[model samples]
Target: RPAKKELIRSGIVRTAGRILSSAASTPAAAEKTMALLEKLSTCTEGRAAIGEDGECVREMVRRLMKCSGAATAHGISALWSVCCLARDAGAQAAAEEANGLTKVLLVMQSDCSEYTRRMCVELVKILRVKSTTSNLSPYHSRTTHITPY
Candidate 1:
């Protein structure tokens, strides 16, 4: 008799993607999604999976701009994970295209938690390093100036 093959269900990344897709309109749902994102940030495969979804990355950046407290901190952690894991130019380009740099800067100046502010600072440094290495300007071409918080 042939050995039975194990069935695989949707992975954490897939579930997180679904949660993030619906999180925009609901605050409770956003909180849950951010928690998942924070957990995902601890693993390289999870980070890569999140980065592969352009919509997810855009939504995370949007959350960074709008969400407060733990949600904002989770968004920063998730973005940091993506930046650390993403070796491709497309990932960096997608982040820049989504106006992530300016949003992150804004978060830095906001009265968010100290952890959130530190994460934003780290994210800004990562983006600057990536931009310099890629030979692109630190700010995206479309982002002329970042408004003060």
Candidate 2:
């Protein structure tokens, strides 16, 4: 955990945002970056640092299903840290604006650990409520019937 603090002290979270946004970032590189991000997100300062950068949040959202299982797990965990754990509404909005909810749903349907799937579900709840379209949480009464507007 000390290493996470050291990395945060070195401003690696900001650098990480740039790396994730770079086109040169490969899947492996993204995975490693997400891993580091998840580690840093364990603390309050780290979550604030990450949540401050909309691009970082956006990139994490973009990485949802764009890499390996490790990468996906790291990405979701980091997002959960900033969005749910920290309860940063701005980060939640940034995520939704980046189409994070859709990617998270896709990830949940894929092969992933139950922990990650649960995190994705929580992220979905936050992102949906924070969406620009509505500020209320989604409720489904198990009705599968679709109604045309």
Candidate 3:
């Protein structure tokens, strides 16, 4: 029997949560989580359901980065993957720069997890390079660039 439309709609959040939990245990699942987060970040309607300012997305990384031992290592690596996407999008103005990256890095740098610290350093390095080129080109300089966001 086909599930009721309402039941299917109600199941979406649970399904996403399951995906996130599984991400912690498997590399393939973690990649899927990153992809799903990226899609959710782009969907205005979906984003609203999660929270204003994509807080849910941020929390996913936060949860992973805060885990202990081996789990923390994988979580931090997963977070680095997510942030790389955000950083790239931000450089092109395709994503909002509301200090999400900055805040996470601050926490990661002080994180008990060595992997988190390393990922934080890597993110900073990438951001430095991206920032250096962020304002280049005639359109950007002229303030007439129609940013994707």
Task: Give all TM-scores, in the order shown.
Answer: 0.69, 0.86, 0.34
* Candidate 2 structure quality by residue, lDDT tens digits, 17-130: 888989999999999999989988989889998888888899888877888999999999999999999999788888988988788888889999999999988888778766
Cα deviation in Å at residue 42, candidate 3?
21
lDDT digits (tens) for residues 1-149 of candidate 3: 13333333464434654665554545455455544543543443433433322433444554443344444454444445544534434222211233334544555655456656777666555544444333321223334356798
lDDT, model 3, position 58: 46
* Total clashes in model 3, counting residue pairs 3 or more apart in sequence or in different chains: 0
Clashes of 2: 0
List CA RMSD, all candidates: 7.6, 3.8, 12.0
**Candidate 2, residue 5: how far the Cα is off, in Å:** 2.9
- Which stretches of model 3 miss by more than 4 angstroms? 1-14, 17-56, 61-74, 85-98, 127-149
List runs of model 1 lying over 4 Å from the truth: 1-11, 85-89, 129-149
Per-residue error (Å), model 1, residue 82:
1.4
Between candidates 2 and 3, name the one with more favorable lDDT.
2
Flag the better candidate by TM-score, 2 or 3.
2
Instruction: Sort all candidates by TM-score, best to worst.
Output: 2, 1, 3
Residue pairs with clashing backbones, model 1: none
Question: What do the candidate models score in CA lDDT, each in turn?
Answer: 0.66, 0.87, 0.45
Better of 1 and 3 by lDDT: 1
